[model samples]
Target chain A: MLKISKKADYALMALQHIAAVQFGDVTPGRVVNTKEIAEEYNIPLELLAKVLQTLAKNALIESHNGPKGGYLLARRAHQITIAQILESIEGPLGITDCSHEKDGEFCMQRENCHIRTPLLKVQDSIAQLLNNMTLQDMMGGTPLITIQSPTAQGVER
Target chain B: MLKISKKADYALMALQHIAAVQFGDVTPGRVVNTKEIAEEYNIPLELLAKVLQTLAKNALIESHNGPKGGYLLARRAHQITIAQILESIEGPLGITDCSHEKDGEFCMQRENCHIRTPLLKVQDSIAQLLNNMTLQDMMGGTPLITIQSPTAQGVER
Candidate 1:
């Protein structure tokens, strides 16, 4: 029942793209633009552009200026955790709105709320798992098909 | 970014109400009807009824037929896990639509989808947490306020 928001998913996908083309610590191997990623992933260019800017603002990826310059990972792939990407896009992982981490008590049953503690624990544990998971961890799943034959291997395989 | 559905939340609340009034094996100390839970939680009666039916269908809670009869925990509170409640309401936890568990591959980037592995891990880990966690774990947070003063202790405290 728990689900990650679509924007957060978009951010993950976008980050994985940059991470895949990552070159070195300071400069990216390829300064992949938003349009390039949008076309490849079939994502909306306008939406993906907004998401990329948010990533740049969060410092997960730095936006390069001028032509041929677009986006690159601010940190190494393995060094950046999925939690950071998600938090950068969706704030800290919150399973329930009435979580202790939330500012004010909006839930009516706060005092008698039985699920609060367990819900908070679930939120923390999920955050912990995501915090430990890096973008490289997700990028690791990209090796099944080789790029030799795009239509055959990449498409059908 | 991750969140449990409202129906699932309602199901948990309803089950907890029954679990709170549980007596012993076979017969409950108190039979809880859906309306009681709906009014108590301020949930819509119709929606909560459908959710309660799902809980009954999943065998998480036993349904009573007569006027005095209502609902009871199908199994002991501790015997029921939050996963059971959540699954009963929302099906198995799914982080991404393109996970291996899905019937057919839908995403165009399925072959090169780098997130499949890590997303599945997150799904499985979350399911693992919910599976191991019993309903009693959430119910444990309900011991703070006593029933002495309704307005003062329960509302203001």
Candidate 2:
């Protein structure tokens, strides 16, 4: 089955939570504590902490240490797309192992494999959808259909 | 990036090859040698052998041992969809871990996760595509379009 990993899903949810509270007059650029996030979401503190640390390392979220420490979005809510979160947590959004151009060159049949073509199409479709969507979109209750509907009439909102 | 695993890709290719040859007196029930498949497609013999074995175990293909041994499609080529091949190799097709109704019950935010709905839609879209495409479609040279294209027209022919 093709599915996103738990870590990736958690990463997106955490990002959405941060985006949701961005309007509050909390300390500007203040770090959001992992404990608060975990408690609010009812997620496992330890696991979510690790996920946050990874996000920080990937520059998806900014982290601070010491007394007034926590995590904050490294960029604006609109600047961060779901693709970035997914890539930070789950590597690349490739559909086949051979679709990755950088490391994928090592595959035995990289040059002439017919399957990579369609798989690449699938990967690109998913990536484009993820890239075009922002944390704000997810928070605004904008269904993904708004961005993906084929008819131009549906896109005109 | 989303990508298909080697096992799944190889299974699709092997099935398509079988479908192509199954026309004209070649019954899908007849055994085919692994070496023949490997040599014809220039695939890695060892890896292809394991992939074929995996398919046979999943009931996608039937295999025999010894002289008259190889593999045959367990079902008609038209009856075997790409989704079945992918599931046989990778398990289930879902964009988020929470997309699975059975497994998603354990998620901490099962009661109110907003993102789950969109991810489920993405999962369903992918499922719909794979389910609509059969191994025979691939063998018949039905070109797969890039996901960016709204039309379902074949790419090559």
Candidate 3:
């Protein structure tokens, strides 16, 4: 199973919530507080806060610290992809460390690992798909997948 | 990050180990014992046994009993896909339960869950990629990821 961590999920949901409110207006000052999002979405405050912090640290979103402080997107919705949001919160996205050439922590059997190269391709396939999907494409009722023959193509919204 | 469980990792490694030894011979009796696989791969015996048991139950592999007994693929290497192996070892492959209509445990805000549908599409994209890859493909030294531009097309080994 390919599982996205809860933190990554929350980061996406939170970003979508903010995007929905902004409605393509990329103004820097328009923001939503963590409490408002948590209450509206029923996400646990602590968990959502932590997820938001990572997003801010990755510069995907900006945070204000005043009494009326809140959060806003650092860039336009179309500029951020699902792959970027996921990697920001959860680290590099790949099947395993053996698939990563720069990763220092290779499995002990990696030198003799037969599955490494192929799994790296699987990883790239996944990364390409995710990288193609943006936050703007995720919002609204538009269908993301269009089945034109056996090959499923993604429609970028 | 999209994550495949350790059990699934071990399962793939073990299956690849068996497939490499078989060398495309679809004979039903070339067996590789769990002990040998665990020792060779440095995988924990208890964990590999559990994963193998799941594979056996799923009928992806046939297990033999007794002192000289071990296991062999239930079908040809080309017949078994990475999706099947992962699903057999690790339940259904998806990012979230909210995407599953029959899944009773929907998030508290499922009615307002804006990302569920798009996430489902993401899950399908991953599954389709995995389904295209077979156990036989993993056994060879062929480059799995052929970068045909930034699209990252999967090459059948």
Candidate 4:
């Protein structure tokens, strides 16, 4: 199971709220504040604040300042991906410990391991599916990003 | 981080050893006991024993009883899949906690979640890739199974 961390979940929810508020046409220049989002979704303020900061630092969303200031999508919703958000919150998504490590680090199991290579293939497809899914696609918006086989892009399977 | 439990990794290693020893043609009808696999992979004997029992119970591998008693593949290598092994050890693979629960159970975030449906799409593709890949495919054997889109089979995307 590829466990999506709680913080990652919060981040996506927060972004969704911001995107809706900013782009819903109800409020053209409005920003979504953390308090409103946290209160609405019943997410913890401190945790949701930290998640928003991470997303801001990662450039997925931009922060605003003023009376009605908060956060807004830095780019179009379609430009952001679940992969980018998840990777920002968590680290890289590797199903196995050695799947992301090219040298296998100090893994003693590496030499005897025949499963690592195949598991890497599994991890790659996971990353691929994630990368192809945009925030717009996720919110029932237009699915502009299409799934492409990593192998088709000259990536070795 | 979709953490594959250490027990699941050990189970895969144990099965790989069994498949190689049993079907490598160097020795036919040989049974691979837990001790051999444990020592070869430097895995703990007690934990590996428990994992072997679970695999046996799942019928992914069969255990023999006698002077030559050990473990053998319950089916041919190509007949087994990583999805089967991982599920046998780690239950169903769901990216989100609520993705597998259609009714959302007692999850409070269900109503606020716009990501669940899209995450399900991601999870489905992950399952599709894992289901199509066999133990034999992992071992560099002829890939008799080809990848198929679940949606093409009339399963909803």
Top candidate by DockQ: 3
**Window of ten residues with lowest summed lDDT in model 3 chain B:** B146-155
Better of 1 and 4 by TM-score: 4
Better of 1 and 2 by lDDT: 1
In model 3, pairs of residues that clash are: none
- Order the candidates by lDDT, highest first: 3, 4, 1, 2
DockQ for all candidate structures vs. native: 0.28, 0.31, 0.46, 0.34
Chain A alone, model 4, TM-score?
0.85
Candidate 2 lDDT for residue A102: 82
Chain B structural similarity (TM-score) per candidate? 0.80, 0.79, 0.83, 0.84
Error of 4 at A85 (Å): 0.4
Model 1 reaches what TM-score against the true structure? Answer: 0.81
lDDT of 4 by residue, B1-157 (tens): 7768899999988888888888787887788898899888888999999999999999999988877688989999888878899999988887777766765374567777787777777777677677766777655432224344343221111
List, residue by residue over A45-93, the lDDT tens digit for candidate 3.
9999999998999999899998878988888898998889999988888
TM-score of chain A of each: 0.81, 0.80, 0.83, 0.85
* Clash-forming residue pairs, model 1: none
Off by over 4 Å in 1: A24-28, A100-104, A144-157, B24-28, B100-104, B141-157
Clash totals in order:
0, 18, 0, 2
What are the clashing pairs of model 4?
A2-B2, A3-B2
Q: Tell me, by lDDT, which candidate is best.
A: 3
lDDT tens digits, residue span A1-157, model 1: 5666677878888898888777535554888999988888877889889999999999899999899889988998778888899888887667776654456647765555567666766676666666666776565334436434333221110
The list of candidate 2 runs beyond 4 A from truth reads: A24-31, A102-106, A140-142, A146-157, B24-31, B39-50, B53-59, B62-66, B74-79, B140-157
> Per DockQ, what order, best first?
3, 4, 2, 1
